[model samples]
Target: MVANGHHWDPKYPEYEGKFTGKFLHSHDFKGVTNEWKGKDILVIGAGNSACDVAVESARVANSVKLSMRSPQWFFPKFLFGMPSDVFAAKTPNWIPSIIKQFALS
Candidate 1:
């Protein structure tokens, strides 16, 4: 099994220097603050961290935009009243991927 920790360095986009607006990595994000209250924000990924940041920023930012290269499957925190992770953990591995996808849909 592959095991990776969460302390990896943030990867910057190639256009980092081209754009003049404020840019920051999700890894460096602390939380929403008054400084973000009226600024336009652009989040660059579709992962959990990006989603969290976008949601939080929307609460205070004048506008928040999420940009991703492609679409992704988004699962809610809860499924059938149980935590989604717990539900996935309890599912038998014998189930086929197609069936799982259908069920989730």
Candidate 2:
């Protein structure tokens, strides 16, 4: 068993008492495979992680569906809620004055 991407050994005398459980992503769920290239698919778990996978799959697959346990709470990075993730990274100085004004105000 491994946790946090670290491999553990049961035989290690130093680790006489340690807890570990297998971690799984959406792909690990049964009946979900990479071969769904042109088939309708429903993916579960859509808080934040699942939405990403579902959107990508929809691009290639015939259709992609998501089954979420609860509503999602999402926030967009923006200047006054306008597109900004790309502009912020590429053009940092373009909005420096506005950012400073917003910060001060």
Candidate 3:
């Protein structure tokens, strides 16, 4: 295995190249122009990074779809002017899990 754990996703190796057209990773678009304008896009995950790509791609692509094997808990990019993850990290551990889930829901 790669030391960084950045190997290919094993879940769908066979499904790879089963489609035509551009297939890009989220990191490819960071700080770049929307070069895929007027194209159809299919983002293959729904994690925060993938969601960012889908949202950005949707602005120019003819159609955009996010593929996920399961639903995920989506969080806002910012809350009260702080990154959501930073805000979440400041949450007190003593708080009940139920309350946290409820508030996020």
Candidate number with greatest lDDT:
1
Clashes of each: 0, 0, 0
Query: lDDT by residue for model 3 over 1-105, one digit each (tens)?
Result: 001113244233335445655545554455325676787777777766667777777787788787777877777778768887887798799999898776665
Q: Considering summed lDDT, which 10 consecutive residues are worst modelled in model 3?
A: 1-10
lDDT of each: 0.76, 0.50, 0.63
| TM-score, cand. 2 | 0.40
Q: In model 1, where do residues sit more than 4 Å from their true spots?
A: 1-7, 79-82, 85-105
Best by TM-score: 1
Candidate 3 RMSD computed on C-alpha atoms after optimal superposition onto the true structure = 5.5
lDDT of 2 by residue, 16-64 (tens): 5653632334433343346657866565555444565666667667887
Would you list the clashing residue pairs of candidate 3? none
TM-score, cand. 1 vs. native: 0.65
Mind giving the per-residue lDDT tens digits that candidate 1 earns over 44-101? 8887788888888999899988778788877777777898889888879999989877
lDDT agreement of model 3 with the native:
0.63
TM-scores for all predictions:
0.65, 0.40, 0.55
Of the two candidates 2 and 3, the one with more favorable lDDT, higher being better, is 3
